[model samples]
Target: MKKKFKNLTFKDALFNIANYTVFFLFTLACIFPFYYIFINTISNNDAVQKGMINFIPVGINIRNYLALTSVNDLGVSFVVTVARTVLGTGLMVLASAFIGYLVTKEEMRNRKFWYRFLIITMYFNAGIMPVFLNLSMLGLTDNFMGYIIPSIIAPYNIILVKTYIESIPRELEESALIDGAGYFMVFRKIIWPLSKPILATIAIFGAVNHWNSFIDSLVYMQNAPKLYTLQHRLYVYLNEASNLKDIISSSPNAAAMALNSKVLKYTVTMVTLIPIFIVYPFMQRYFEKGIMLGAVKG
Candidate 1:
């Protein structure tokens, strides 16, 4: 590599510089939002409101976070979010794999019909009004079921898993079947193990979706505040925090109240995003490999 670089022309050097510059800018652009949030979260409330805190935190402060700790429903939202993320991701991955595997089986009756049916949904949008009405009809409103059921089986995820499963040689499962292993046994002992990469990839997708989703919670759980997810609760806090002017006017601790909402907003954002940030690095390699194998290899 050093030898090749030594022989490079001016044009080659220019191209290399341009490539590095573009990537540097892109990386900065991606990182800036988090940095801005971090600096603001740590900075004084007045600094944030005056647009004084930028890339660097101007004045160190933790009052906003202190106030956030005392806020109601924060703990409840955290529990709801964690429960939904774990259960929803597991169920989604299993359902995706089951649907994906079923479609690939040549012997399954109506294989073509099922495959085409699932694929068609991807290209179509069953608008929000219809989806909400259907959920309401099913009595999912004002319940945790509203959070999990709608996203439990994603068509795109199923298609990805299906492609990954198809790439796996079928002879192993067939051999296991010939040896008297039932379909479930073959799937349990063979298919699932081989499909771990793609499953891990889809697991991240499902978990992120479940954790970040607030629209479902808003639309269905408005009447059931106990069922609110962390995102929804955070949304409420952010909105209130942004209106510090109103809060200061009515509060006894007008001086302290001014900083509470704004600071809490930034802290809440960090808290909400913490899980994904913590888990992502570990899953990234598998996610990349799975995407290539499941979505591109076929």
Candidate 2:
């Protein structure tokens, strides 16, 4: 059997065409930079340096990627970045979910005040020096904990989680309590599982932030090369001639091809972005749904 299409009016057809055209162009605009960078990274080093490689690759090879393996501290930096993203995202989601659950409880004393206190920090900035001094005083400076501790309690995430939990029927919690479940058990058995959408959304946010963070490492971990995240190392690799030269010299392919700084920078960027690219597609549905629903009630 043949399926029949509904007839469309001229205005409707025109509108649909315009909408599709606009979105197609917008998508292309978004994808082009990454595409351009990727082709440049794989294209011949001389052409890339001379800006000859544009829409497509020329004399493509994997030398730039192979060269990256030889960078000093690259392995350690990769480890640090992965560790930070995983630990930071997990702790942040848990803290947000727990605190979000707490604030939704009517019986928790001073809940409003505590919520306000947390939200207030989001609005205020104590200059960088003060924050640095505070971290130094607390022994977080030069420590991996510097990344995890400061980001664990994100107020914005808490608000989203709290709002999301509020949208859940109170009858669920009341029924659990009537069954003699304590608040913690009720939360663990009921609320936590239900909040998966928002939690996944927060995890995406936290992971991206942690993965891309370099300023914290730059400021606090300057003396601790062992603690450098991938982004910070990339920053150093781009800016420091000695570091770039040493890294290039260490890679036989990079040395033979004389890979320029531009190729190195683009390759490192794509490498850093690869994990997020792999992860986001799986989580995108939850992200869109959570953000919409989370925003609706609040």
TM-scores for every candidate against the unseen true structure: 0.89, 0.93
Weakest 10 consecutive residues of candidate 2 by summed lDDT: 1-10
- Please identify model 1 stretches exceeding 4 Å from their true place: 7-9, 59-63, 242-260
Residue 125 shift from truth in candidate 1, angstroms: 3.9
Error of 2 at 124 (Å): 1.3
lDDT of 2 by residue, 102-179 (tens): 999889999999999999999997978899999999999999999999999999999999999999999999999999
- Model 2: residue 83 alpha-carbon error in angstroms: 0.4
Predicted structure with the largest TM-score when compared to the true one: 2
lDDT for model 2: 0.89
- Stretches off by above 4 angstroms in model 2 are 1-9, 252-255
